[model samples]
Target: MTTHIPAAAKIVADLKARFFPTPTYRQLQLEFDLLLEQRRANLRQGRQQEVRGLLVVAPSGAGKTTLVARVLRQHPSGLRMLTEGEERADIVSMVVPSPATPKGVGLDMLEALGYPLRRDRSAHIIWQLVKTQFAQRQVLFLHLDEAQDFSRHNNHNDRHAVISTLKSLTQSPQWPVGLILSGTPELLDLVNMDAQLARRLKPVEHRPLKTSVDGGMITAALRQYAAAADITLDDALCKPRFVHRLVHAADYCFGILVEMICEAIGEVLLAGEDILSTKSFVTCFSRRSGCPEGLNPFVVEDFLALDVRRLLQPEPGPGNQGRPR
Candidate 1:
């Protein structure tokens, strides 16, 4: 028996596959290319040397993960392959586990390298296995997403150990591995904890979107996404005022802006409508934020006054104001 998927789900999936090459993405691509070039140069010179890694710091919903995934996917030697029943991976990617410790992260890395631990092991043993697995798999680049969890420890020594382990990965004499550490802004503090580590990582940050600067891009995205879904956007919805409100509704994040556009398109498509309008966006925003019509930027007259960043948070308790969930 075959199962049928809804038209809305298909459209949403297609929309999610689309990528916008923003300035940040271009910068990330250039940095990745440079890192790969350094690796090649080292190989040509027949020298074992440490290579610089990337430190990508951004706020929540800034598309850091998407950007890194795209870069890795496009690289020539990024994917794993099976040759003669042997697995070889040039890139190994994993998310840093919460409450990240050196041991926990080391175990996660080993697992990502297809060498899951059979039993509990010391941090030292786990990392030694990780380094061995990295070399065995021919993994050159290690991408750790949500890496800010490494700083969650209250003990200064524990945090220092995490930083040291990351530094050591890029400086391993036998097989130096390039690192791609992406996380929230706090990750910067983690890197800065050690001066040597800070110097080894090339930092790339994702800045918040500016309404005046990004308005045109956001407008184009709306039209492009609607056209992709075979829906025409209403003229009023593309006006500058609405575009600004749309940016605000997305909390000035590029990824969130794209998501909102896709959501609005899905709403229209699922409703058997051919035209995309403010009502579609209003419905999508309401569904995502659970905000009342009066507080919704897409539905209100004074949208600028709405604290969109707080829209998804529950109401504040007495004296505890404007806290996020």
Candidate 2:
């Protein structure tokens, strides 16, 4: 059996080989940098205040998760950060549920922190265990990715509880835990729903990168990243041409430069005789699933719709009114 390699895939493989860990887009650099510092300091510190959480809102693929992973791995001390299995995680990270509610968010938090969750364990019991271990360890950093998923199908009351719980995690200065929350801007409205949660989270707001309009620091950063990656796409990620496509693709938020360029490279490779030109790259990237060009827009729309459903996860009926019922 022969494994056929497309031209685009070959180009992307070449690009990835050159830039294994591609630089993140410029817009998120500063915040991400600060986040790195916060994580480092949180390690081995007994009573230091953790950096406040970041509430980054952008399209789906803006490199947010990759950024967090990069920061954790790149640290000099190299303290181990593992996913939750059973035991508590002193310093752990994971994505929050869409339509974030106390229950959903709490479950994710529990799982992320490595709590031995069971139907048998009461919420009170779980809280005690988590709080005790965290306080003892002095774990100041808690990174929550895809937090926009915390949207609750229920009422304001549920949202408030979830917010309060997060706040409680940071209440004791002796055992304070700074959070990092990244997701879509709709989370802003979700925050508004729960005044106290909004008040406490004080989310360090973030917007998507722009390659065309802004050209000072952020633009320069993208150019630098492109240079590092040895990529000469007509528009840097900081430019409008690239950013616009990302926004439409709905991956402009948590997705990373590495993923985009690599995907584009794959697209270019799959383009038969087309060389690895930027046109081929972007044209291929414009479409999802590697289909023809015309179908790109609709595919993106379908994905966005899926994202909404996944994010909102509204409770059964009534919320949907009578149309479907």
C-alpha lDDT score of every prediction, in listed order: 0.82, 0.52
Give one digit per residue, the lDDT tens place, for model 2 in 148-179. 66553546666566566676776655566666
Estimated TM-score per prediction? 0.89, 0.63
Least lDDT summed over 10 consecutive residues: which range in candidate 2? 303-312
Question: Relative to the unseen true structure, what is the C-alpha lDDT of residue 44 in candidate 2, on a scale of 0 to 100?
Answer: 55
- The numbered model that scores best in lDDT is 1
Candidate 1: tens digits of C-alpha lDDT, residues 1-325: 0122377889889998999888899999999899988897887998779978999998888899999988888766555532334667777788888768888778776766667895478988898888887777767788899988888653798898888888888999988889999998888888889999999989886888887887778778888888898889899987889988888788778999899999888888777778999999999988888866766788767677677776555543575343332
What is the overall TM-score of model 1 with all chains considered together? Answer: 0.89
Error of 1 at 98 (Å): 2.4
Clashes of each: 0, 32
- Model 1 spans with C-alpha error above 4 angstroms: 1-5, 76-86, 118-120, 311-325
